[model samples]
Target chain A: MKILITLLASIFLFSGFALAETPEQKGLAIAKEDDKRDNGFQDFTANMVMLLKNRQGEESTRHIRNKTLEVEGDGDKSISIFDRPRDVKGTALLNFTHKVGTDDQWLYLPALKRVKRISSANKSGSFMGSEFAYEDVTSQEVEKYSYKWIRDEDYDGEKCFVFERYPVYKNSGYTRQVVWLDQKEYKILKIEFYDRKNASLKTLTQSKFKQYLDKYWYPEEMYMKNHQTGKSTLLTWTNYKFKNGLKDKDFNKNSLKRAR
Target chain B: MPFIKPHRAGWTLLFFLAILALFRFPVKVFAHEISGFAAGEARLFPNEALFPGQNDQSASFALQPEYYHEFESGSSFTFVPFLRVDSGDQERTHFDIRELTYLWLQEDYELRVGVRKVFWGTTEILHLVDIINQNDQVENIDTEDKLGQPMVNVSFYRDWGTIDVFMMPFFRERTFQGTGGRLRFATPIDDDRVQYESSAEEWHTDWAMRYSHTFGDLDIGLSQFIGTNREPTLLNGTDSNGSAIKIPRYEQIKQTSIDASYVVGEWLWKLESLYRTGQGNENYFAWTGGFEYTFTGVFDSAMDFGVVGEWMYDTREERATNAFENDIATGLRLAVNDAASTEALFGWVQDLDTSARFLFLEASRRFGDNWLLTAELRAFIHQPMEDLFFDLRDDEIMQMELAYYF
Candidate 1:
């Protein structure tokens, strides 16, 4: 009887340990692995462009000659130049994003001979009439949201970890977003946006990942689509350079006029 | 249909906006798409007429199409093609192209040339009756009704604010009633008399400039407008008293305005003033100021309230009417979960000159990111007077609108 009792207890203990390893736990582990592959991007810069199509079937293409200076523990500096249409040729946008505070921005208009600061917190607005919102340009800081591990799944034949995250910032555009992370690298594969009503409004897909500096995985292109409007925005990033030692003064309003 | 000669400014505005659109696209790809809406309303409140032509109703529609392309060098281009139709008991429902334009935006400046909308005046809150332009009021009017002049304009942004300047060579729209026109009266002066004559100019140019800035806690702005209104003169010797009078019908007008605002925490205060000059200008000056507060209640709900006042002065040698008006308004806006919100506003406008009053109410709500609705009701009331111009007994109007944005 003693032997039988001991055997039964051992069996129960083993089963308990087996049940503790849930799909969520497995997904989290996979996500950590992917994060390792994608992490350690200290600083980088790129230029981007977008083409917008209106419901009237009219198309407008916007050119952004952009430069970014990022740091691992400090902040990021960004400058954007509008390069098409002779009237707007000298327009420049500059931003100094802090690691723990509000970002400062300045736009330089050649016609106005001045720079304008964007003070309003209306980040949900379309970016220059494009499908992308103003918030889309901001860097995705992991600590800005609360996340929950959902499950481990195979996406596009690659292992992925699905996570639901809620924005903690007051000025965020959406209530919640579900993100898919590559299991091999912490790179974000896709994201689904849910509006205030909890209805899915849009989806973003990232692809064509390239490893730079032997440590950072970068997506060369991204696409976002509005489910209801059938409108779409494609972002193509090119001419990337890393660790340029950008200074805070470079993002000042005075620099806007010379952004080009 | 009688065709009013196209205003030279209108043609220029269309061309400008079209060119802007052209440069935004890839040179090899040129695509054009058309889209707009048509709305018709037949009045049934007072009484319905048996026949459509006899009904006290109006119907209008608009078609706005856009064209675009991409260039081999990765540049962009765009053009907007527009048309309009309006019909009513009055036979003004003729077909016309309301807008056609091109636009181009580059790194430092944006150039918009063509026959397109050239908008000015930077005021966030305007009385429903004060804004003569429908495009400025997003919640009201069809797309074509909100259209503006054909001109070339550009905007430059800096750290403090934005500076926008434009040269409009053509502007085609209805002019305000003055000089004892039939439309100037509140009621029909004669059964068969129309309020306006088709007026068009060959080629004229106007200049406007706007500057907006933020300094510390204050937001400041200034705008200037100088232009000419070229109306067809009465046919060779047609006079106001029934004699034919031929005089230069075209007139020149100018306007200048200054505005400022201050915001601290939940409290916001703003002020604006405008002055006008020139012949046949019917010069008018106006100023307004207001403040508002917002707070969150239990359960993390939000509410806002505010009040404002305004004054206006009319200066015309012929009319010789000086009027001062003050308005007090309060609004309640509420939100839940910071996702959905509803707002209701009430206002009272007091006419110190005539000792009259106008009351108004407006409400708006957002169901989600895609859907929004708004409604407004206004009533003009006062003691009877011998002026015999404005029937201040019981004049009321209501408007409602629904919108979906993508």
Candidate 2:
């Protein structure tokens, strides 16, 4: 009779969570689920346009073509080819991101036909005169940060799970980031970045999330605004296609020269 | 593009850039596109000219039009023809086919034919392994410009690395400053009276091979070249007019070189070494090793500061024609990381044996989307009489180039 009663009680317990669950555990679980939804995307390419606005609302534009190759056990490899500002045309940047070690970046100068190995320490600096830092555009791996559950809230009329995460990379410019992810699709909707001094620096809002292959979700636009400088950058992605059969060879340093 | 006056041509190019900047730019990049730059340059010397007819200041104008096309059949063609018109020196005002090449790309290998420029080195202050194209020294004293060489090349990419083989048919001779140029030597090189060690002369076929690999944070390259030397041995001779001139004699030589760089976060270690057998009395080995460390996001600002220090050494002491044979170079690099992409480099090279020093500064900043301003200064100080650069003792040059790209 006692064993029967114990079995009945166990059946009433929660299936996805333990009887005693911490906020950290819930946050980690949410991140893992969010990451799991983005799996199986072998490759992707997109044409991106960036509009940068300053304090007086003066604006400039930049055009870039980018490609990404997903790695099964590690972070993704990416390449960006600059197309605008005519002087920098044919210039390319190749990046290799690792989940737990050093990342590598190489810059190809078209004028000299030379490949230069650049330090990844530029993560804290602005990317192409935009409000977005290099770290902000890098591949988001769950292992790169530690998280804690904050609460559930309605962000812009969408049901979101708010969480706070701290970057594990030593060279990261942000002290912490507050993220809001939609609970249904597990897609990140917003991020608030805090500077090294724990001051609010920038806010990034992602919108127009589109689903591809019935499993992957990508934001069509991302807007980042710096609070201190009153400058903003809006990234609009077009012609985004996934599963393009891009290989590892496409992301090497040598391939950058021919990435036209 | 050629034989145009300096100031008027510069104004015309600026107007062209403005009109092009106003229009909706290019949409046919995949198929083909036309892009290049036009510039107005002024070179001023602080000291008196060394030669009789040389002037303290020179004005020049340059224009380059490049056309690139890639077809769906895995074949591509590139054409870049450059022209410059100068008000002072005739040799400095010339035309060049920078690159006119056809490329056939395949999965494992690619083939290229025609005139092209190829660079191979890892050192910053000095390039020891870069021996493919002949230097266009009249364009700049730093040897950054090159006269393209006619070659047939095939490159193969494998799991280990990449291998490139070349068969160069015609060699280009190096260009030197003329008597009217402010930076000319005591006696200018007579290109018309040039000599060659081989009977085949400039038509001698050259062979070269290179293997380059990147593993983790390390990038390495090994190359071998068997050909006529690029740096000519200036023999004291006379020109066709029987005037005192230096006859440039090209020699057949062989060289093997290795260049490698190991990057560790903000610190990059670089080395370039070479072994050559022909040119001088005996065979020699030369090398340059250095490290560059950068401090990014300096003091919470969007700026980067880089410190560079290198040691250059050569086995042949007095016989070495290179001024940096036994020298140390230190430089500072600064980048604003701003929208304009402003950057500056300050370098100083000191001879170990003598107290001679070479100081130079190069800075550039973009004014708008298409206009760029570049300024450079070079000063030679404390030179000994026996130094190779003693000819540059009284020459201090300041140069400015305003370029418009489209």
Candidate 3:
């Protein structure tokens, strides 16, 4: 009787384990949870310095002021105004992203005294000649990619969940991207990009995260290295101020011309 | 005139004093800030001018300062003052209000009043729809520079598109190079002799309206203007020396313009066209269409190469003063995605009927912290005497400029 009872108990436990969720289901659940935790910030303004290095190790820096406003049921809106290099000073770029459709972008050229609408198909191109692409700097919506949880591993002395995501938008340069998120805070710590040919293209690492308002987690620095070319860009963010009461009107095309 | 007029030497002194005053102002004056740049340029003509008494070199300096103040309720004020001093040409040495406007922003509408500059059109070769401001001819021959226009503008934003209405109270005449300038005609243009078709002349009330929107990869705009024509027709006249010359005569006209651009991948296709009825029933049409293709990260390097081509046409052909009727323009742009933001562009425009060609090369880069250096070369070939640019055939020259910003 004891032997029969042991056999039945083992069968029941094994069946329960076999009915667990798949990798894709697990990844979708994780992404939803991450998005929920990051909501309700409303708006933010920050200053950033981008350092670019070439194959020869020559370096150049750019200073910019960044502002972002969260939109309900869509991606965030952002504006970046350049303040350095004299020649490009007062140049501004406005981005209006969407969850299911193509994004809208406009560039304000101070010299031309006009605002130019940029092509959304050029999202795969570099941003201001940096290693980061236009899509990389833009706010990534949950609907932008389909995710699949790869595995769990230890990264930087913290437990991390690794996932592979495929972009849903057309004309994207990358075929897939692998991201590492810490289990405790659900914050992204590293990402690897693959080109359209399924070749390794770039790696981005985030560090120096500081909690704001005791509820928001933002990385103070992000570094991106291009694997194809021996070039890299380091973005150091400072003066982060959240919940600035910025409204939808502040992110319109007219504001682009008025941006300092 | 109530405007200040300082002598050549006095202008330099006043410029420095203005800079000093700007620096002395306190930073905490309002909720916004002030910023600007100062630049000096020295131009040299490699060859002798076709006209007599023209100088081979000229020195010029410009100061532009901008100020902004924003209220908590979304109302804002902006002031931009511009001053330029040319040692060789008095007409180029002048000051104007580039922009001094107050803006009130609402949930879906905006209102602006004062002097402002507005630009329109998409094709790089020609800006046919951009007629809000008069040309500042003394600034450059490219037609990209403009004098500010005084007006009241109202804009309404909607999900479908944006509608803009403009009411201009005064008209501004186009500025031309003085007799002493190298690029001037054999006879000088007397500013006071300028003629106007309207009885109100410079004070004629003008109006314009524009509708613009974006649909997916396509952006389009349509606008109409009823006012004094920004482009003046040259009329027979005499200068102070009693020699025959051309006097600019502003005419009343109605113009309707349309501009559109389609972006696909790394390619951009643009078109700009306009129809105008004025100058004694001699109405005509003009259009420009072009495309640009860019190869990013060429040869696995941090560089981009862009090829551009455009065609310009006019119903009146050679009779057009722009001399671009029935012409083709081609250009190459190279960008070295370096930290200094270095770039170079080469363009050539050729008349299909006369084989006349105009070529230009421009390169610029930034250095140190707040300095920018630029160089340019211009040349003309096979220009016919009937063309407007015929007098500039011998003006092939190279130029270098250094600018500083604070």
TM-scores for every predicted model: 0.53, 0.93, 0.89
Alpha carbon lDDT of each predicted model:
0.52, 0.85, 0.84
User: Per-residue lDDT tens digits of candidate 1, residues B242-304?
Assistant: 743334344555667777656554345656676765534356665655665444332322232
Q: What's the DockQ of model 1?
A: 0.04
Provide per-model DockQ scores: 0.04, 0.59, 0.51
Relative to the real complex, the DockQ score for model 2 comes to 0.59
Clashing pairs in 3: none
**What ranking emerges by TM-score with the best candidate at the front?**
2, 3, 1
lDDT of 2 at B73: 49
**Top candidate by TM-score:** 2
Backbone clash pairs for candidate 2 read none
Better of 1 and 2 by lDDT: 2
Q: Distance (Å) between predicted and true CA of B355, model 3?
A: 0.2
Q: Quote the TM-score that chain A achieves in each candidate.
A: 0.80, 0.94, 0.93
**Candidate 2 structure lDDT:** 0.85
- Cα misplacement distance, residue B377 of candidate 2 (Å): 1.3
A126-206: candidate 2 lDDT, tens digit per residue: 788788888888788899899999999999888999999988887888999999999988888999999999999999999
**Model 1 chain B poorest ten-residue lDDT run:** B129-138
